[model samples]
Target: MSLAQRWREARPPVAGVHLDSGACSRQSLAAIDAAVQHARHEGEVGAYVAAEAAAPALDAGRAAVGALTGLAGSDVVFTTGANHALDLLLTAWPGERTIACLPGEFGPNLAIMAGNGFAVRPLPVDDAGRLDVEGAARSLAADRPALVHLTPLASHRGLVQPLAAMSEVCADLDLPLVVDAAQALGHMDCATAPAAIFGASRKWIAGPRGVGFLAVRPDLAQRLQPRLPPPQWPTALSVLQRLEHGEANIAARLGFSVALGEHLAAGPALVRERLAEVGRMTRTAVADLPGWRVVEPVDEPSAITTLVPTGGADPETVRKRLIADHGIVTTYAGVERAPFEMTSPVLRVTPHVDATDEDVARFVDALAAVSA
Candidate 1:
């Protein structure tokens, strides 16, 4: 079957046009069923026994994360969501509480770092808010913050960060790099190695909500050491496993495992290619709408396209009208999503690989009417 056909068959159905994959994609029916089955099994066999039974699937999920993120499953730690994963890493971070990141870093991440007692500093970036690689390397070498945090793809815009080059720089300088791949994974190539990479299952992966992960390099895992003792006697769990909380939603995790399996079966490379095409289609179609400007370049390799409404039209109002009147879903990106870079709110549309030309056209028609 064609990829689109398979994607359509995998999910049940939606009420209306969904153009906010950047916020959350539609979960496959298999993923939903896996979670339901696990929940039922927990009630039948008791939670602990059911969890023990799910070991293999959980391991495979970690392996899939490793395969996609260029780390080992042994170093992967599952958390509630991307925010939780970042908390685990930041709270456990050693040395001086200072970190460097791009100006357009995810806003909540800045809050997390600040709450963890880290002082925020900006890395060098060009006019478009993309990292200036050579300048960034020099800045890192000179300033030498405790570590570097990077959001390869921000929620407010579609510009892809230069992670591979930054990763090389961090490697050469022996600096620890923390990557927020919540928007990058599943939507684009995310195979670069960093000190740690964390993301959610809900976004591009179309996994269940409340499931996220953190994958640390084995060496970094060893360095972080144990904050709390393991629940079991004799401590047989790996370092990363010890970092995981004792209690978690087994059903959601099982669902995430199923989602990971689906993603792998669909093929990550093809999935990315399809998303790029969807991005182009969405951008080209929406750019033609009157009084709304597409923020990202037409060919930017991201599924997300930020739309800035001209003539002072409120993005929040337009977003609400699109949903309430037109039955089309999209998200509004405010300055709070990327405080340093975004001056005002912009509408964000991110259609997944399953999206069709009709979907784009529906959004275009709805947006033009709402804005008019």
Candidate 2:
């Protein structure tokens, strides 16, 4: 069966609403199914698919990500996840290096750098969640950072960072800009400039879990060392290495290609426009709801929506209520802040290409009921 047909067959029946693509995208089920099928067929199933196939489905998946991200096929490397990609990328980063990130950047990245012994610095962001480019440049200059990390769209806040501008700053400083495009990939046009772009298949591209790619500029690839080398060191890099070498994701790669093909058949411009329309509708519906404020900008490139509840409602409490009482699924962002709790508690909602207008309405209505 075709990827879409496979998707239709495999997708689970779920209830009221869904809005947590940052954690995972329901859209990726088709690609995952395809990957699983191909993996099973090749006897390349399990973690060592990297070693079994000369050109594994996982490699194909990495290549597909490179195509989507505007990188050369050879520039892409597969990782366990976006977080694994981040850790691998920063593993060898020079010492005392300052990495600039948005205040509301994904929390795990900060923890990774801290654990790895890099100094982390927060850049200023406007209310809409765009990074202050000038400020970022100044910080980079002051710190003489060895590497700079950014999330094109802040997963927690649903904000789109100005990638081209940030790329320019990194270019000026001769620094490598590592973009966490986990949320931006499929939803936005990628920059063609040289940089390290990491993304997960589980989010916007709607692929499978345990799959992600890191695209390094062709020139940079030679300079960086592989975090995990294949068993046959000099002979050839494993499937992961071949992925780093630019092998395509056979099954999911085909599925991702199919997904992008569908997006193109629908027209990426049209897909983006539809997402924006749904986002606007969701924002409008939530505007009048009591004690709920939309934190992310309405015009951001991503389809994620972040809501902050007023009136002392705990985010976890509301999230559980939405799931249990209303059949609506959502995500909470305040779980990590223990010592000094973050004042702005956020709940995320994500809309996919497959999501319907009725889905949006049902989700909003669920939110209204939960808030009430």
Candidate 3:
């Protein structure tokens, strides 16, 4: 059986047509079971004792994340989630307070920067909301922001920022770059690292919520100073170990490890191809819907597609109707979710590898019916 079919069998049946993987994916059976089992173990063994025994599983989780992101096992440490990870990275950075990012940066991430007193500068973006790599390079060189941040796959839009080129620019200028891969993790061959790629496991990895990872370069990690001191391993001492301290959700980490293993077994490249195909099919299905506009370019990056209504029909309303009436799921993309104002309100439609052509067609038909 195909990986998608297998995954679907392992996961809970979709409540409706689940096209909201961009928001959060349903966890697989193995992940769910692992979590439940760990929780049970903790209940029996006592939390701290169970946690201490979970060392192998935790190490294995780190190794799994390393395999996915092309980092050493020592480079990754589980965090509460992407927001926590981002906050930790930013808090620890003892550099200039100027951070360069696209105007369409994730809302919470932008808030974290501003909250932490960083001068968040905007890097130019094209009409499609993609980063202007040349301008960014120039800005980085001329202004020398404390660091560069990119969300390879942004939350509110379908545009995939040019990471390879941006990374190249950062490399040439010897600048530090951090990637928020919350939406890109399981969809892409995230093998490019040395840049901190932090994300939640629930989004694309199909892992349980409350767990995410921060995989950073050794030098950058070395410079990091976690706000909270290590609650558990006060003496273990490496930057990652220090970061990994404090009581953690052992169950969630084990579940995340299983989710990562599932991805590795299928291979990242194959998963990317399957998801992109489904995305293109979905885009094509809805491209000609009268009065609706597709926001992504012809050549899209990830599996996310955003559609906007030309009429005054609210995207949020349509999203609700899709789920309530037609059993079709989608996400409303509002300006508030972005750092800057969105030109047009949109609905984010993201499908996973398990989605079939029939599923895409069903979603488009549902969309048209609801919009009508």
Q: Which has the greatest TM-score?
A: 1
CA lDDT for candidate 1: 0.89
Top lDDT: which candidate number? 1
**Model 1 C-alpha lDDT per residue in residues 182-251, reported as the tens digit of each score:** 9998977778878999999999999999989999998887777555573345777677877795799988
| TM-scores for candidates 1 onward, in order | 0.97, 0.82, 0.95
RMSD of 1: 1.8
Predicted candidate 2 versus true structure: per-residue lDDT over 63-116, tens digit per residue: 556666678666776665688777876774434557777776677777887887
Model 2, backbone clash pairs (residues 3+ apart or across chains), number: 9
Worst 10 residues of 2 by lDDT: 335-344
**Model 3 lDDT tens row, 89-186:** 88877767889888888899999998888998899887767788988888889989878898888888777677778888998998888988898888
Model 2 stretches astray by more than 4 angstroms:
1-15, 28-32, 42-60, 94-96, 127-129, 227-267, 335-342
lDDT of 3 at 51: 83
Measured over all alpha carbons after superposition, the RMSD of each candidate to the real structure, in angstroms, is: 1.8, 4.5, 2.1
| Candidate 3: clashing pairs of residues | none
lDDT of 2: 0.66
